[model samples]
Structures are given as C-alpha cells and as structure tokens.
Target: MLKDRNITLTVPAMPEYVDLVRLTLYGIASKMKFTFEDIEDMKVAVSEACNNAVLHAYDKDDGTIEVRFAFVKDELSITVRDYGSSFTIEENKETPAMHGKSIDEIQSGGLGLYLMQALMDRVEVEHGGGTAVTLTKKRQRTEEPA
Candidate 1:
C-alpha cells in the first residue's frame, strides 16, 4: 500500500513564486520515484495552474497562493488555490467547434487547463470563497525480479 504524506505552502501571488512551487514539486515527485518525463509533465502542469491563479485570482498584489502537495504511494497530487475568479474544469475542456485546429487557432485562454488535464491522471476544480485545482498523477510501477 502507498503511504500518504502532504505539504502545504503559502506564497505571494507573483510570477517569482512559480519557481518555488516547481522546486517543491520536484522534491516531492523525486521522493515518490516519478520518472523524468513524468516529473517534467508535473512541473509544467503545476506551473500552469499557479500562473493562472496569480494572473486571475488577485486584483491587488496582496493575495497569496496556497499550494498543497500530497503523496499517495506512487501517486502525487497537487492542489493550487487562490481567492480570485471562479472557473469550472468542464467548461475549460470544451474545444471550439472547429476540430484539428492549432493551439493558436483555438484562441481561448483555457488551453493551460486543458494541458494540465491531459498531463495529469486526474484534474478537478472547485470554486467557493476561492478557486482550487487538484491534480493527480501516478508513477509507473516497476516489476520485481523473482
């Protein structure tokens, strides 16, 4: 069975804090034995989520972004929350009427949310007093030699 561990961090809602989140995620994912590619994907997804919160969550520069990291065995889950705009995960996943269009053609800013959903095994968004995005990804299990 996988063990569950969690860490929480609150930082200023600024672009500079994105690197702090990336580093913290790298450490947790490394301990969970995530592959290099998986680590890369997680970093990108987490960064996107954080960026969204920083850009949309606060009108003044006084708010903070709360990041929570949870490790469940080979799976790592991240939650990014901000007290700003409200958004739905389902709404963000819709594609324009046109199919096979390049990302540039889509023109909607929710592409980051779409990419996060694609990269993570699970993605959920909650909006109340704040907006929170939960992302989960599992590490590939390795076989033991008999």
Candidate 2:
C-alpha cells in the first residue's frame, strides 16, 4: 500500500508559494502518524529547502520548484527540484576560505542547509540540470513480538 503513496507539488519560486509545501507536508506527516516533533522538523526542513530555491534558484521570478514525496514501510522521501543556480554544502564550506572568512561565518550563511541536515535523517543534493535536494526520514514502527 505504501508503494503507491507518492505526492508531488510544483510551485513558483516565490516566498508566498512555500506555504503550500508546508501545509501539504503537515497533512502527509500527520496521516503517516509522525510525532508532532517529527512533523514540525520536517516542515521546517522542507521550508528551508524551498526558501533556498526561491532565493537562489532563479535570476528572475520566472522559475518553479518541484517537490516530490514518497512513502515506504518506514521511511519518507522528499525531493525538491529547481531550475536555477544553487550551491552545495561543500561549496558553502569552501566559501569561507576563498574570501578569507572564517569557516564558522561562511557556514552560518548556509544555515538553511545546516537546518535541513539537522532535521532530516538523510539529505542528498544534486547540482546538474538544476538543483535537486532529496531528504529522507524514518518513522518508528511498533514491531510485533515474533
């Protein structure tokens, strides 16, 4: 049953459009029985990803970000795709040295990336053909004594 539980959303890369992502995620996470804490974490992480796309993904307000979600037995996977420029975690880590800024200072500029990592169980980012950020989280399942 979980195999077919895939959800997707495509919204303009505008700050106002991100609310849809958050609301949809809340509904899905609630339906999946995630804890309140977990749902909140996911919402924050998802928003950060979307915000990044909106802030960096386009030279103008003419792009859209696509978010897709999939469910498995005990895992939720969400992928956010954008068709504009984006920087990776390593790029953020390296930016400090290139401009003689402290790593801490530069890293702070990438706070969204850090928050997403801290909240999600797994995060993978791809840069080609637009940026794709995939986040995964595991749900605790009560097991039957075998």
Candidate 3:
C-alpha cells in the first residue's frame, strides 16, 4: 500500500511562478499514474488558482502564494492559498449581458473560477482575511488484461 503524502511549496505572487506550480503538479501526478488527459485538466485547474492569487491577492504589497498537494488513497487534493485581499465567487459570476455576447464582445477576464470548477473533480473556496482554493481530482483505475 502507498502511504499518504503531502508536498507544499511557497512562491512569490507573480505570473511567472504559476508555471512552476504546473511543473510540480505534472511531476507528482505522473508518478501517481494519472492519465495524460487528467493531468492536463489538473494543470489547467491549478494554473487558474495560481493566476487568481498572483493577480488578485496582495493589492499594493508583495505576498507569497502557498500551494499544498496532498495525496490520499486514490485522490489528489491541491490547495492554493494566499494571505492577502479576499473575494467571493458570487462577485465574479458571469453577467447577464455576457450571455448572448460573442467571444470578442465579451471581456477577457473572470473565467478562472469557471475553469477551475470545470476541470477539477471538486473545488472549494474559503475566504476571510485571505483566499484559499482547494482543487481535488480522483485517479481513474485501469483494468489489466487477465
């Protein structure tokens, strides 16, 4: 049996550091036998979370973003946390005007939450003094030839 494991990393709140998160995720997920498609989904989900922290966390001051990866049984849970300004998903919900508008007509931002939810098996957001987004993905088992 594989023992449960946790890996944590802290990076400066910057756009460039998001790629480091993705690289770490890929390395760990690949070792756990996650499918390529699933890994890609996770990468996108994690990237979105990191991007949110880098862009919205810390209004006028520098801060750090903490990423925690926990492996339990067949599930992988990733938490991206930032100790800075906080916001709610409701505040970023899509507007009615954006419904019928074309892609170019619509805005370029505010899709991170949707992307995270769509790509991950579960997404939980907590905020008070800061924001924490936890994304979970379950590993799919493959049947072996008998």
- lDDT of candidate 3 over 1-146, digit per residue (tens): 33498999999999889999999999999988999999999999999899888888987548999999999888999999999999977788644467778888987668888888899999999987799999999999999999
For model 2, the superposed segments whose C-alpha errors exceed 4 Å read 1-3, 95-108, 142-146
- lDDT for model 1, please: 0.88
Q: Which residue pairs come into collision in candidate 3?
A: none
User: Highest lDDT, which number?
Assistant: 3
* Residue 100 of model 3, lDDT score: 73
Q: Model 2: which ten-residue window has the lowest total lDDT?
A: 94-103
lDDT of each: 0.88, 0.86, 0.90
Q: What is the lDDT of candidate 3?
A: 0.90
Model 2, residue 64: what's the lDDT? 98
List, in order, the clash count of every candidate structure: 0, 0, 0
Model 2 scores a TM of 0.84
| Candidate 1 residue runs with Cα over 4 Å from true position | 89-108
lDDT of 2 by residue, 65-104 (tens): 9999998877898899998986766777654343766666
